[model samples]
Target: ILPNVTIRMLLISTIESLSYDSQRYLGNFIKRNDLPIPFTYYLYNNETNLIDYKINFNLLAEVQCLSTEHLIIQVGSPTTIGLESLNTSGSQSLRSGCIDTLFGTAQIDQNKEKSCIIFDVHGTILSGINDTIILALQQYASLQFLYVTEADLETNFLPSMINNSISKPTIVCIFDDHYDKHLHDEHVNLVQQFTNRYRMKNWSHVQWFLIPTKNTWLTQSDNKQYDENERIQTLRSQLSYILQKINQTIIDPTLFRTIFQVQSLYWSLLHYSMNTLNYDSTCYFEVESELKQLFNDLSDTTDNLLITTPISYLQSKIKQNQMDLPRRNKTKFVIDEVQRYENLLKKIDQISDHTQFFIDLLTKRTYMEVLITEKYLEQWRSAYEPRLRSELINEKHKMIHLTSELKRIEMLEKQQKLNKSIDIQQQLQTAKENYEQSYKTLNEIDTKLMNIDMTIGLFFDEILSISDYNSY
Candidate 1:
């Protein structure tokens, strides 16, 4: 093993049948001392038989530590009554094989019994046993040891693990180096069945490696560092592969939910504006443009696989929805215009009271002015005009008498009478001109009143026509 290699080893057996005290002591000793690899001990309940123990073992080995690279040693008599049918060879034979594959040689005590198996800090086997024993180990594993029961693995661990893996990514490796083909198949098939049942294939972030009896175990202690280094490099490569897959496939549910919420809010606001209040197309487009820009900016800010996928999806959805906006706004504008025209008609109809007041004032003023002008005309025609005519006749008679006498003094007196007649004629002419000017003013006022009435009538007609058109 390399100085930096982090190794984990598991020793499992029943408390009753195995040398529990010795295994526990050895595990503690390895953990307490400075060592390159770590060791853990697991003892089945004294009451549990080998069958239940095997089930527990398979559960932990296959599920809990699936992604971990660890050495698992079974410590018990293989020929125990309940376990005899489990494997063709004895438990000692399997232990011997594992030791042989790890250490390349076997060590024996004075009683010819296999002693403790030990690996130095450098992963050199200080003492062990060996021969043609087969060992299986994963070339690449990415996780550390995890202690869990079968029930926990099925009920809690697998579900949570799969969920977490979908968010990020993970690779799990399982090595089935057992001599029994049925046990090997059972171990690999169970995991496959579970993954299939849960639809794990849909998630591209998780990967599974199931290895069957491959004789790729390290044969020499000298090659331990090289093998571990190679495993680490392979794990790094796989991690890169997983990251690439995540970039391609992962969609952020949170981002999608957020975008959906925004889209819903925008639609709600649009509906409210169109149905309840003033709907300004220019203002709506301005707000919509801002929202689009915000979304685009958010998309540009992050390189996270989760955020990017949903952002792209929502952008497309927004684009599709935007295509219908112009048509919807056009309809809204027509509805608004119809509503405004209706309101204008209501306002015009309500002006009847004020219109009557102005009409009465104009008619009364015209009548009063016309009566005053007629009175002035009657004063001129009945009194001032006759007096002037009588004076002129009198002057003419006096002038004729003076002419008949041919006297100079009498003629001068007649000329004075004639001048008086002319002055009266001038006053009558001024009165007639005043009457004509008053009549002209009255006519202009009447024309103005008629124009006002025509304008009011036209306004009403336009409002009614618009109402009828809208109804049609």
Candidate 2:
């Protein structure tokens, strides 16, 4: 006989395994059916002696049942014989007995008052029995009986269970090898259905283990080498491994939460730095310092350091470029001012290109936050920058032509006394008209520049909205 603690641990492990498996199953079901529903799993172990366990279980069950549409409650090892008695009896007795075992007589009316489906599977069916049993315990409660060899469990039975379920139903499959290949294949196929439904890349959520029944019932001489405590520890370790396997299948929700915040902060910093580039020559150093601090903060909270490496490198490059900028304040000549303006424009282009590069890098990752950021970045890069650059180039060319015409007119005016020609007068008139056109063009460019700034501000606002919406 097993000690109470070992038995409790075993029961807990089994319930946890089933809970995770059901979660995987429901997750798949929702995706496959294209249903707008969230899934949750709750495990209740009535056989455990801990009063706290019972209290917490009841509290959670009540909360989950009311809160979620897709809720699964799995009760573990409720009676001495466990779920073994459900398979041997017909519908009426199965209902009465399993109901009492699962929820004590005191709690039966309360459990029956709630709307949920109860499902049971037979362990002995792993020897290859073909059976389908459905028991309606009450108007609100029902018990489903399934055997390992039944074809419908995968096809008709499970689909029906999910369809008829007011809330998500907990499915329990109990198996013992019996070394039968066909029976094993059926079980494998059943599990594969869930795996395929969930679109899992691996068997992380599926719990399959071989329990050493013979070792548990060993004679004193056979078990002389190992003490009771050692055996219990061994059993506990095996159960722990099974639970760990299931835990590894699902991505931690906390990681997504952290990534959401990090991605938002990253985009905000990029936007702020880009905007500051328009006015501040020393903004690169300041932005780089801020980014380094941000990276350090994120690195402390998450294991995804590699994802931030590109951004870090970009910041370092910006800092280096800032250090290399010419220190002279005012240009001595017009040509020097022109050169300075060109250098500033080139620096702005580099900043924009690098910012785009960082956003592109984030888009390659699979997180929703990254994808959303990428969408906004793509919109800005594709629509905003090219048009702005084209307009700037056009305006610069017009300014250059106007400057050349003004110089020509000055030369012509100096020569007008010497030449006294009608053609010179016409040329001067044309130069004045061209200068007036240049002023108009300059005004248009200024207006466009203001619009471009407003557009950029709007883009930043949209990004901020995305961050706010997804923060939770």
Best by TM-score: 2
Record all residue pairs in model 2 with backbone atoms less than 3 Å apart, i.e. clashing.
none
The stretch of ten residues in a row with the least summed lDDT in candidate 2 is: 130-139
True-structure lDDT of candidate 1: 0.32
Instruction: Name the lDDT value of residue 209 in candidate 2.
Output: 30
lDDT of 2 at 153: 28
Give lDDT tens digits, candidate 1, residues 238-318. 545544444333221112111122234334444554223221211122223332343333321232112222222223334
TM-score (C-alpha, index-matched) for candidate 1? 0.18
Per-residue lDDT of model 2, residues 1-472, tens digit only: 3333332244334445566335434433433453222111223546774322110122122212211011112222222123233223333312231221122111112222222222232222111111111111111222222222223324443344333322221223433322222234655544454445535323232343332223233545455556556656654665455444333332221111111222233344445642232211111222233334433333212322123332332333445445545554432443454455445434422223333434444555333333333333333334354566677688779878887987887787786787778887788788878878877877765554433332223334333433443453
Assess each prediction's global lDDT (C-alpha) against the native.
0.32, 0.35
